[model samples]
Target chain A: TKISQPWKTTITTDESVTPWEDATQYNNFYEFGFGKSDPAKYADRLKTEPWSIEISGEVSKPGTLHLEDLVAPNQLEERIYRFRCVEAWSMVVPWLGFSLADLLKRFEPTADARFVQFETLFDPKQFPAQKSSSFPWPYMEGLRIDEAMNPLAFMAVGMYGKVLPNQNGAPIRLVVPWKYGFKSIKSIVKIRLVKEMPKTTWNMLQASEYGFYANVNPEVDHPRWSQKTERRLPSSLFTPNRIPTLKFNGYEEQVAYLYKDMDLRKFY
Target chain B: MLKSRWVKALLHIALLLPLLEECWQIWLLVNGMPNRLGPDPGKVILEDLATVAIWLLLLGLAITPAKQIFRINDLMRFRRMVGLYAFTYALLHLLSYLAFILGWDFSALWEDIIKRPYIIVGTLSLVILAALAATSYKAAMRFLGKRWKKLHQLVYPAVLLAILHEWWQAKEAFNEPLLHLVIASALLGYRLVLFFNKAFSGIKNQQSLRQTARKNS
Candidate 1:
């Protein structure tokens, strides 16, 4: 994986004061354990030292890159955005990183780069949950070439001010705030640039519901469920059942251009 | 060779029908295509339904210990049915997640289970439930012998995983998870006490036999 050069900035948030912790520590990754507290509990065992990402497919240069090399060259920036999950929950976080568009441009996606596929590191010995067929582990995620290069998408190295906690896709992860939470693939190890749209794990498992473009728009109803409202984690039961989802997660000015002339209702 | 009228009646209505009903409901949730159940209700209801199934299964798992600790032996009969109900509901839960949550996108499902901690944990609990359900039959028990007990022990971890799955998603309050945690703990604790009690009795019996032999000599 080829990461671009330095674009430094003054650290906006406190790196020492625990950066910006997620308003809620509990995460959707329940394989390690099931409590809202489970990831925080068991994530400590995840070894971030000596992490490496296996880069493959369609790229002229295909190889693995160490985590140190990936973050070493890049400068961090704080971009606060709203993260809306498909489960109808939402959160606001100040994520630290640079644009994914900048990073992908360095790799020089070829004319054949129609879509970019990402694979999470799947080692059952390390991540025991991978062994269970209940889910095909080393979970995969993908983006159309244009989506991958969207300016809002961040190839994040840190969140808050400091390095990412292991529970929150430590080392590096993709943060597509406007899209559904699942679009933000974490703890990535492989990047495969491909001609055809790669089968994202969830999309392949059930194509009708999870489309290739899992944009977080209120208008698009997942055939069996609604995307109109979100729960906002840490909210009380009386805190209203539905909060109208925004288009482009409130970043329409920047990203709406990418979808011009395209039917969002059909494409979404 | 002999069949009791009550047992036969129970084997059909009490046991068989609920199983059938549970499967039918899951089929409705999973196999039925769009518009069969009206418009998509949205994510909250799906989450609610999944949590309900998880709790119901935990309740079913608790029946055996509940009966033993409370000395309500009759409750034992309901354990299998309740557990099956949990799996039945879990199957629906899994389907909803695949259909509604992931939009039946296997790729997205794969990415989530790998990349997201909550999805990974929730899926783990479902897998455990699947394993338990697959082996619930008498034929499996007869085939495995002593290993059957060990395999069934997975129910404990599975229940714990289920609680965690529900807790993480609940997000709103700790009250529900805490309550379910307490119930599951008590049920598990009863098993520990039973094990020690049985072990202690066996040791006392051995000692008494040794003393009797020495006196006779």
Candidate 2:
């Protein structure tokens, strides 16, 4: 199960790394519950083992693949990426995974595959929040074919050099560094390639608040709150260590070209 | 119950418990202890204080009805303390939000109050609570006389506004706010029934007095 580390240089940042305990404990995994600490408290019920992802739509090899066989071929890498939540709190996570492109390529996506959609485990028995009508139960997220194929788009199976804790998306999850943390669907049970842009859970719930391409843009704000600044997690008591949110979460140099001529405000 | 100093002291402690608990948690958080406030401790504290403030407001409003129904005159003595505590919590909630969420940025706070509907409603409720707290003393009560009662009537609308503020701020889980709304509605509904009953009895008494005068003539 020990795959060779493909990446040597850890993604460095000016900000201090968030404590692993804080990062794992404070999360917005609504499948557990609405509260921030709900995931850490209730995610233990999740059965991460004996999991498989169904690959369908626009793929040459459309079939079910066990979690182990799916990740066996690719080498895992340690990526210390900035994780910006839509709620204006941020964390730097040291994730271990292979590039999502590598996994998608193995399935032999057809030319018609313009989008790659991901879906989280939908069983109400494991996820208690599924019973609540707050949001659509099975969390779904999507990325353009080129975006999914990007080097920064990762399929994280572990974090802090250990197998992902149930709260932190155990088994396998997508980690798109440039977008908000919610786009990185956790406990993924399905990945479908399609010609049209897929409807994401948040966007479907409230299109005005959440958009399809949830790129971390400072100019564009969430309908409820401003996203211009972010409070770094584990901030001090008196002063919140707030920093200006970067465009595309500081990956503008790499991913800005993807939306060259398109208006980010409209797509946001 | 009001004659007993020990009973009064116990009621005071019980009323202050929520604020004291929040302060203790904040103290732990400030000292780098793993506190219950969670990651965004300031935000959590702000919300907790606001929620407790509204609960205290409702409890204060419930005192009169409870006293009337149960025939407990001593309940009125605790109503002022509860109302003052509600005001204190509301002040703390606003200060916490301004200091923590807005980072002491007055312009941003002002903008929020002006632009955000929830903030506007919350601020209005706080303003009304402040006025009620200010006029709560005997000296102010004497100076205002008849106007004091009318001014204090604003508490009803303030409670309604506070409930609406909480409801508007709710993003996903509305059960908590909805429960508060139901409780507020029931309290107000009880008051309405009492007012109409009093009005009906007053009319009947007037008619009886007229009939007594005719018999005397």
Candidate 3:
């Protein structure tokens, strides 16, 4: 258990935020417990100091990077984007991040590297959600090599302008706005570049529920429910049911070309 | 026979009206008809219907327990009503999802059934709930008495499906579904514990009684 020592901000945020204390305070971090407020209630007691990420696999640099060292070089930029969960609910959040493209370039992924996999921080001692056999803990999500290299793919450090709250993946996380929320793995502690398609935690747990790409495409519906529509969250009980989900969550101009020749239905 | 005829007629009429109302509501939604219900028409309808269905099934399950625990035998009369409402709202959940969300397109709906896991669970829940609703009447119950209890066991699966459906669908925060699962688990757990306790005690009493009778003989 590494205790966090106060480190100077080598990388400054392009901006500052009021910080959503409540966002992390009120919700259940099911990754920790089943109670809705349990994660928030208990997460406050969590030790957030001295986090480190194990960078391995096909990467040229395979070593543990401290939280401070990992974030020291990157310049923070705020990208407010719409986050849509596969569950059909949605939320618009302003995330503070830098491009994953920049990070990958630093590691210099080999030409054979076909996929980038992120592993969430998964110590059973801290994250109780790992104990439950319902779904695997330290949730993992992956991206194709191109997808990971895409400028749109982000390695987020903060949300709503302030440093990330523990419940919302405090240290660092991925933000693929064009994909469903789960594709954005949180509290990442490991980054692996691999030659073959990496087995994502959710995909491995239930391949049918999550896919490798996991892109947000309304045209490609979820096997069980129509992804054509979504419920924007914080909605009142009487609010109308759904709004038509947009293609690539309306980011088609940036990402549509990547899947130009591939059939989304099959990939989905 | 005439009195029974009247009862049957009343049952048909009673079930028909709610079914029609649900259909009418769906039609209003599908045709882009005006609904002064809420800010987000589709979500408003879904949440409202979900709440109604959750409570309805809960009420349905409450009948037998209430009758046994509180001696509230009159609760039996509301069982059909609760089941019907559950069916009606679940239907609305499916329809509003199809017509409004999927724009009544078959291709999109088909893909959804094939592609999404949460949706698969949600759809299966609805199907099971629909089956339970389809056989709610006294005639069907009389025809499938023991089978009715067996069929209604599908309720357990349906409730779990509903919770998963809700949980998997949540966006950023998982407070609502997590809370719901905990409550549902507790309720279901209590019943399971009580069943074993009663079953074990019944066996013990029967064995002791048999022993006494054998000695007397």
Candidate 4:
């Protein structure tokens, strides 16, 4: 079924959109596998239907909410956001979703809810990579309450003016535009309102490299590779589309206030 | 024994195919046409070159062990050709990074080799390959004499460094890198076993010669 009213909004990049093929095909969904194309190839295994997300912890309303009913209250808006991967590749994608703040407010979180932790579907049968004990299963990510409530922080249900493909986090996913793409956890199955900071997947894997606040900062390089520049997707061999990466992925003016007092480098 | 010359010719044609395919992809990119290389052809090409370089390096390492096991002396001649091709691919891989990835930005290239452990490891492996390729000719072998053999032994470390480079680059995904490491271990392990066998049971050359001299007497 098609998404309801994915009308275009001003919250979009002026840059050219990454081709749907590239955006969908070239993915790092480790649940399916590690290869760039693995997710696209093996995503059929995921069962997005009969899907429900458990909203629990410090929220006033705690229950397993079916995906349809959860998405029913709000109007879906089209947002073309710039997605910058931690590996120094980037894409401009037109995502369809309602504001995350809109979704979180419905849950009626208590004052105790300082952090919001999200989890992906943990079914090893669907996610074959979960069979490997290399990474702690059930990919988890968290954002501070303020960060979660930020207007720019979106919960994408679809992209490219249609329902999100199973490989591209079908049904639901978070889209924190300012952070590196990994923080925008895919195929979310749980949203827990907790008091303490949550242990994130990549950060848990390598604390020295991926931090909790993976804000796209050009100055702050990943220990392994430079973040100063990114190869924009749909780029060919001779005509390179490598461009200088912008701070906060060019959304610095909008979201920089969220980390006003905190040093991004230290947090990153 | 299979003719090493014929094998070398076939190997050249086989290796040339991938490079030719890349060239076709490059042509497609230049002409602004759709290509199979994917969105970032430059990155894809860079990876392809690196993959070929490492595979060739591993194949070069496997030659001696394979020859020993199969008792095919003809296999020895192909090692130099394999080593040279491996160096060529490695050189092209680094060049691709400089040209496509960096856009000829020497500063970033310098910084990457100096600071980034993966790139540094990769560069070190390539440098060792370069040294081996430079000294592979007969004149260099004659000039260096016994030292040449000692220097060529650097192939073990060179291959290990390349594997380490691959491991460093492929951070979380250890499957492919681990497989490469296991293969390297097996190839290098065979040589170690032979060395230790000769050490413990006495050198085969002297022992065989003594038996032959006694038989003659």
Best by TM-score: 4
Give the residue spans of candidate 2 off by over 4 A. A1-10, B1-3, B107-117, B196-217
Q: Order the candidate numbers by DockQ, best to worst.
A: 4, 2, 3, 1
Tens-place lDDT digits, model 3, residues B101-214: 555667766766666677888888999988988888889999997989899888988988988888776543466677667767766776898999999999999999999999
Q: Which candidate do you rate higher for TM-score, 3 or 4?
A: 4
Poorest stretch of ten by lDDT in candidate 2 chain A: A1-10
Models, CA RMSD each: 17.1, 3.1, 10.7, 3.6
Give every collision pair in model 4: none
The TM-score values for the models, in the order shown, are 0.55, 0.90, 0.61, 0.92
**Which lDDT tens digits does candidate 2 get at residues A206-228?**
78878899999888877666778
Q: After superposition, how far is residue A18 of candidate 2 from its true place, in Å?
A: 0.8
**Candidate 1 lDDT over residue span A22-109, tens digit each:** 3425566544543444566677667777889766677776777887776666666777677787766677666678888776766666
lDDT of 1: 0.68
Native interface contacts retained, candidate 3: 0.20
lDDT score of residue B82 within candidate 3: 66
lDDT of 1 by residue, B45-133 (tens): 35556666767767776778666668877776666667777777777767756665555557655545554566667778779878878
Global lDDT for candidate 3? 0.72
Q: On a 0 to 1 DockQ scale, where is model 3? A: 0.13
Q: Write candidate 4's Cα lDDT for B1-217 as tens digits.
A: 3684676678889888878988998898688787767777788899889888888888998988888788888888888988998999999998998888887878877767665788888888888888998999999999999999999999899889988888887658688779888999998898999899989678777889899999999
Which lDDT values do the candidates have, in the order given?
Answer: 0.68, 0.87, 0.72, 0.89
